[model samples]
Target chain A: MSHAVHSPARPSVSTQTPALEVHGLGKTFHIGGLFSSQAVRALHRVDLTIGRGEIVALVGESGSGKSTLARCVARLEKPSEGAILLDGIDVLKRDRFQASRTFRSQLQMVFQDPFGSLNAAHRIEHFLRRSLTIHGKGGTGQGSEAQTRRRLEELMTTVGLQADMLDSYPHELSGGQRQRVAIARALAVEPQVILADEPTSMLDVSVRIGVLNLMRKLRDEQGISMLYITHDLASARYLADRTAVMFAGEIVEEGESLDLLANPAHPYTQLLVSAVPDPARAGSYDPVHRARLRQAVMASTACAFEDDPHQRCSSEEPVRHQVGDPRNGHWVRCHLYRPGAGAGGHALATEPLPEPQPAA
Target chain B: MTVSQTSFGSHEPVLDVKNLTVKYIGDTRSTTAVDNVSFSIGAGEVFGLAGESGCGKSTIANSIMRLLKDPANVAAGSISFGGKDVLAMSQDELRRFRWQDVAMVFQSAMNSLNPVLTIGEQVADIFTTHAGYSRKESLRRAAQLLELVRIDPARLKSYPHQLSGGMRQRAVIAMAVALKPSLLILDEPTTALDVVVQQEIMAQIKDLQRELGFSVLFITHDMSLMVELSHRMAVMYGGRIVETAKAHDIYTTPRHPYTQALMGAFPPLTGPRVPLTGLPEGVKFHNIPDLAEVAPGHFVAPFDADAEAGVLEGAAQ
Candidate 1:
């Protein structure tokens, strides 16, 4: 078992500022009667931060709060607790004007289903034109309409689309084309950070890589910090620099993408890694073993062992511990990495985590 | 592995779809969803159709079942199941032939189950409609079908929403195979499911196919799963089968450039992360001109240099 000392929380490294900092984010949904019997806690004290120019992946199965976390970052859904700080400003605390102004070119989101996200009634040029006009990015020259058209063509070319697609409606285009259009639209705003929630899952497997490669190109050229949310570890590994594995609304494990993937510290991470189909090792495990492992993992409660009594397992809340060098930014939240004993130094120095922003 | 168990049972093909073409008709130009697709399923064989989305895998499936709605024309080809031409049959005849001889389990088909009805009644409905069985007989058969699919017979009373995704899928499988159809068409059957659930569903389906001696035309986009489950596989590209070969050969040495790209396209978890690759730099769509047989029982669609050059020119323009 990979082991390290347990540290519940640690302060952000002083020199390295986070592009987006989130602390103690929470969301709850109430259902049923006045004396409501059911209150679903979707997110509980979720804390995550994406450093500048870094692509942090939020990965999990459906309902694991990966999408919820993405929505929270995008402010598409309001969080019940905690702060969302984008580039040193608390977005959740600022006024509408201040928030919009700051976040206008700062943050933007790309949805999963390109077809569903795009307006079917509008032509491709209409969307690109609106985005460019709204952001005041297009040229202010003679024959400006022509210039805008040229700019739209340029954007289309950049996204692996053709000039003819400008007049084409969403319905006329295939899924990959629509996604390319969506990416072009996102690029129109020139945002510093892009939050893509399963952006390629709905696309064909053959076209999925093309979109992912485009995103990587954009990230490198534009220096745009991206939060790529996906359930597939392979895709996440291909694109993301760091990956935070979320399970039932908590960041159960997080680390450098390759390290965490190759040496998954958490049980949940191991289960996810094992779940990925590797053609090399087909039929290694029988149906019985697969079923047993799946059942055991699913039945395990979300509450860390310490929090709930019935939890025969130790702490359900991971004992946040560093696996590799902090400089490398590898952190895991599992008992397997109990600080100070297993792999590295026994007593890791504790510092206060980033402070929560004041409420609006 | 189980293919041999029923190989000698019948020389007759379970399903032979010849030159099948489906076009969604409209006021102007109709949209061709499937074009000149020809394939046959031997008795107890799992004939896999692997393709990306919009490649017409499901269209062929829908056409085979005669479940096409209005404005949808079956322009050409014949779907012969158990020696009966399906496309040539009238609506009345098709209805009688549907569940009794040919069953289809669509992608996310578990959702097709009625949330209001118990699993038993839904499955029993198949028997009552197709076999004209009494309620008592249908219920007993439903329980037995559930057993065959590896689900507890007690789940017959459970609503569709009450079961796990795997169980719900099993329930759907139970319903499909309730009448023991000679041929089963599964269209991306486990697409919506996770890998573990997907594997379990595949295993259960394989077990049932082996025991009951039914041929399965398993359709999915995932190549690895196809290799694991399929006896013979066909790769579809832009409404055409670009390649058809034994599953082992397709994996070991894929002949088509499209197949080569597809096999190398996916980044597996355990493997070293290779930068995601695609068709040539500017290829818009996945359409190969013609499939050529490279070996006995193995066919591959070669990359058309002219077509590739044309696509590049279009991109340039």
Candidate 2:
């Protein structure tokens, strides 16, 4: 494969500061009027980082607050707490009222639905050209017209689309093609970081890989950092360098993609991995057991592991415990991995912790 | 295991679709949505039809339920359920045939439910209208149906919005199976659901089919779920059934290029990662030949020169 030779080594963590670092990020939504509003914590002290030219996947089920984190990072929502460091600078503290033009140019967001993201009334070129003009990359003058046309063709080619597609309306393009146009528009601003929220979820199975490959190509060629958010674990494993599993608005597990998925530490992450339909696996899902796990996970605000003997799981929040090789950056937030807990300590942590059996 | 337990193909199929052709008649030109496609489901069997969007899998499901409207017309075909001609049914017969003999669960069926009405009222409506039961008796039976799907009978009083996405979908399934239909057509039933919820729903569907003895015509684009659930499966592309075989055979040794490509689309979670370029760009398999029995019980469509060339080029890249 072409990418086999071109596949760069996984970016080293300590050598350079990350392109984007989110520390103790939190978001809470209030329902009803101010007088009698109910506070819903959509995000809880979330911390994640995307190294330069690296891809980090934020995976979770629906309403797990994965999308909420992305919205907060993109400055679409006001975060209740924590810092968003872009290139070692805290953008949240600097941009108190609104996101400045520099912050906007440095960070771009690609939404899930390609059909809804693109305007049906405008041509593909119109969207791309508008982004370029807004970012001061292109203009309407006669001399700049030629330059803009060249840049437009370059964007189309980089996304692996024919230049002729620029003249076509958004409706005429396939779902995959529309997604490529969306990515090209994001790239028009030459942003250093991109946050894609379920980008390939809407495309057909066959065409989905094309878009994924395009994202990988962009990361390799342009050295742009990205946060790929999706509910599909297989795709996350296939594309992301690092994977973070989210549950009930909290980061439950974070590690190298292959290591985390192959040996999930958190009980919720284990249930998620086992739930994915893998033709290679022999046994089928047990609906009764799944129902019990689902109920336990949703009903409890503390640890999802119901079998934990330690009362700390129910009474207090679990902290991040280093598991497996420390250099691999694999960690989990579960009471089972507490320092003095029977299951605590590394080396033997390559396998999953003890299975959690919900009470009858 | 489910497929091996049942003695399929020896008995008359519960649902037999033969030479089915459906077209959408537009003003400029008519487009064939489903072209000369044929498949069958035995009693208590699960038959999966998989393809990308606009591949006519859903169109086939819609035609079976007689839900096609206006521009969508049945161009040519014959649909027979239990040796009775479905296309020849009168308005009254059609009404009786639907839900009584054959039921359907559309994509995102959870949202199809009315928010204002309670789940009990909705499920009981089926019994009162179809089985001619009293309102009290229907409500009692509705509670039983909810219990069968493992939802609390007390939830029968709750509105659709009150339940979670998974519970609402189970409620929809309970209503579909209330009439004890012989065949159930499920079109992308778990598309909008999360993986865990999707697995739970599928497992429940499998259990229900076992207990109730009903055949299933499952339609979806996800191949992994199809293999996990279906007994016999068919792969469709561009309005054509390119391959049909037992689920195991389709997963192990898929003959059709399109089927093989579809299998390669999903990346493995385990194993050394490889750069897999999913279905080649702009390569549509046109002029597909009819399915031939290449092996005993396995059928595959012979690829034309154009398709073979396209697939080869894609593989080379």
Candidate 3:
């Protein structure tokens, strides 16, 4: 909705491998008493990819499993079943120490809470130096010392923090400053892919925009790929090149951010877009007239739209229906958009059940 | 209903606060959380407070409720609601004043709901303690309150875990309005809910306010949500009210650079998209800018008048 995160055409993308790829991701959490095991399906065959220098936002609500997906990609929580390839390396398959270090360093994450993720005991210098040392970019040799110091200053300046802040502890800095330190730490490794889970969600409005702009500037200047996850669609639209609307652990829609926002095909996406409190429409919002929430059905055999129960929706899960041009196409998952699917089901799906005709 | 409710002339304000200041006393250093903040809410008005974390919006809300935690004290201020002095009230009067006169609905306040108690029991408990109602009568009133919030009255038998997040929030709102308190202070009420659910809850609050004639003090970091839901708003920065104006003007023609930045912070749902920029590099809250009024009922705190004049003029058009 704001600045363009996508730059002009680079070297042909088809020739280069994707920066990060996740295939058939499934995460199951076993809860309840030990005697009575219960499987809570957080992710269901979810697949996501990030090309070189691309930012893909995973948008969803509290229980929509977006956080779980991010955690899985970060390898903080091992996936129940899936394969993750970071910079063409099998992230899930490799062992923790030596073999995986190279690939693991290719990815880093910025968490939601700047306070919780950062250690209060450490100064800005500690975090910056620690990240560099872990990635083998630190040391005190004639060549390495000067290079490391230059890198530290560059990282701080890139995030818009003053070099004087390097000596200050996390508690002394403001929320935005602390977050800048976090971003600096993420960039210390010069990671190809940065997984930001609600990075600005905890920040104030003015500070949030500053952080968003910094993120965009980083991607534009350094060409770092990012996975931006958030619950706010507007912020996501502002920052992401491509937007994926996730509901109940499945992508309901994915497309160019602006196009998807302008013409949301999925009922859930439409509801989300419409729910955005329009300042222009102040004092006249009609929440009652909007699309209501529908129960989720992640079962592939059945359509995800539980309210609009059609024969096809019940019998088979609706796959992505291509809309618009292929290069910048809009894709939605709903039975109503399927070819030859008549207007025979619930009106909620944009296909109203046939109204009875009066005698002419 | 837009007219202030005071005496026969109907010119006095409903909830009038003046120079409300709060400070958190640490062992070594005492930090001022809220300083010289002043505003008022009309009989049927919605006054909004917009600011970031530690900016003292919540501290002001808590101080108004006399719910300040230990180590935090309301240093100076006068909070009078419908002619009753809030600061001077006795402990018993404060207890009665809390729910019966002014009630608060907080961010994720639904979590405060007792897990062991039924939704109906929680509402009934409020009645029994606050209004001294019988068990049966309170349950009856509780059901009506649930219905008021568009929730099924039958769900009153369910526990906190049984209800959805939105439902639990609505239930908390229902409890806040159970006595039809004259004023309801909602501090980031729907920040935790989904955007759609948030819209629904705000709509419910608006409808209830319209029907019950209770003033609302709404606070959030969201400029768009604040503009739509509030009649008038105050923008707080570094524990001070940096700007104040009509909700419409706050969006369409904000005078303050901070307010302008706040409006730009949220990407417009509709309208020509502009790159979110113009907040100068390395600007934080500590720098106190002078708040000035260039027009009637509009206050501003520009970063620097000469430098930001271009933005102010642009926003005006």
Each candidate: what lDDT?
A: 0.74, 0.83, 0.77
TM-score of each: 0.81, 0.89, 0.83
Prediction 3 TM-score vs. true:
0.83
Cα lDDT tens digits, model 2, B22-45, are: 999999999999999989889889
Tell me the spans in candidate 1 whose CA falls farther than 4 Å from its real position.
A1-15, A95-101, A133-154, A291-317, A324-328, A335-360, B1-8, B19-36, B68-78, B90-92, B115-120, B136-170, B280-293, B301-317
Question: What is the Å distance of residue B292 in model 3 from its true position?
Answer: 7.4
Per-candidate DockQ vs. reference: 0.34, 0.53, 0.46
Candidate 1's TM-score reads: 0.81
Which candidate wins on DockQ? 2
How well is each residue in A118-168 modelled by candidate 3, as lDDT tens digits? 899988899999989988977666789788888888888889888888989
**Model 1 score (lDDT):** 0.74
Clashes in candidate 1: how many? 15
Q: Which stretches in model 2 have alpha-carbon errors above 4 Å?
A: A1-15, A32-34, A139-142, A287-317, A336-360, B1-10, B304-312, B315-317
Question: Which has the higher TM-score value, candidate number 1 or candidate number 3?
Answer: 3
- Most lDDT-accurate candidate: 2
Tens digit of lDDT per residue, candidate 2, span A19-80? 89999998878766979666667787889988888899999877778999999999999999
